[model samples]
Target: MTTIEVKCRFEAKLLRPAKPGNDKSWAFVVLPRDASEQLPRRGRTTVEGTLNGHPFQATLEPDGQLSHWLQVSRELLEAAGSVVGDIVTLELTPVKKEPEPDIPADFKEALAAAPEAHKVWNNTTTLARLDWIHWITSAKQLKTRAKRIDDACDMLASGKKKVCCFDPSGYYSKAFRAPEAENS
Candidate 1:
């Protein structure tokens, strides 16, 4: 079989804005609109790329706008010898197959208890599973989270293939967003 190479390249500032100078010292780079447009989809996109000459893979999250952003971990920064406020070079290509996401322990047990829901989940696409996980984990309150898990099981058992009323891009609901820049 032949392979098709569809790639996009751009330069962006590597910003270390999330919980700086600690165990959670995180960084990220945003893809400009023109470059983001070349991507396969506007929703959360997974890609394998090189960051400042170091190879890496990440899921690029939509910024609620037309663009996308990446969350670069501290370990990634150190591996590439990159720092915040530096112009980082990147090349990305969309992954044809998404990797499986880890299921939360509570959700795992919930699924196991509900055979129909578990079967539906097992048959759903990886991306849909990711959205379900995202919807479940995005809840900020404990009670809300438990309710979501219960609702997810019910929905799945009812033959709902995807999470209902979830805005993965977070554009309208403002539920999903990149880490705010320290200077912003």
Candidate 2:
């Protein structure tokens, strides 16, 4: 496997700002071509060394951004007397992408049913409906994929237009159980 290692300084803005002490951590973005050899799931590979004398765990996002959730205490930040402007070094070792999940047929039917709106949505690339399609279709299981579709339909039918807030978890609970396989 080919691994790309990058050294970059985190600007602190990438961290979850809502969480306290998040500014002390750093985020490393990675794009792994293979689907099964990524970090975190396999085991801890020490992606981040000591940062301001504190330890941290590197978390991988679905978008391929590796985030180091620093274990630094608030007292440590106060003692070091540093704020968001402080630079933190990050070393990212590329892994592999997870396998793309399969989308259910019902979900595809739901998308197909909105042919006119789907056409309109496809016309507007700025709205990210295509990205939503990609995300929804990536589910590996039939039930999961159908749930994603139902959630997406509910959101689109409501005239919200944006698919980012559509939660498949809720739909999965109510629908999408024991669904038949979808033809790609």
How many clashes would you count in candidate 1? 0
Compared with the true structure, what per-residue lDDT tens digits does model 2 show for residues 113-142? 976555544444432554465557657797
Q: What is the C-alpha lDDT of each candidate?
A: 0.86, 0.42
lDDT of 2: 0.42
Model 1, C-alpha of 66: deviation from truth (Å) = 3.1
How well does candidate 1 score on lDDT at residue 83?
A: 82
> How many steric clashes between backbone atoms does each model show?
0, 7
lDDT of 1 by residue, 74-184 (tens): 888889898888898998888877778899999999999999999999999999999999899989998999999999999999999999899887878888666677774
TM-score of each: 0.90, 0.31
Which residue pairs of candidate 2 clash?
A: 34-97, 35-97, 101-138, 101-139, 101-140, 102-139, 102-140
Model 1: how far is 21 from its true place, Å? 9.5
TM-score of 1: 0.90
Q: How far does residue 35 in candidate 2 sit from its true spot (Å)? A: 20
Model 2 ranges with Cα > 4 A deviation: 1-63, 66-108, 115-123, 166-184
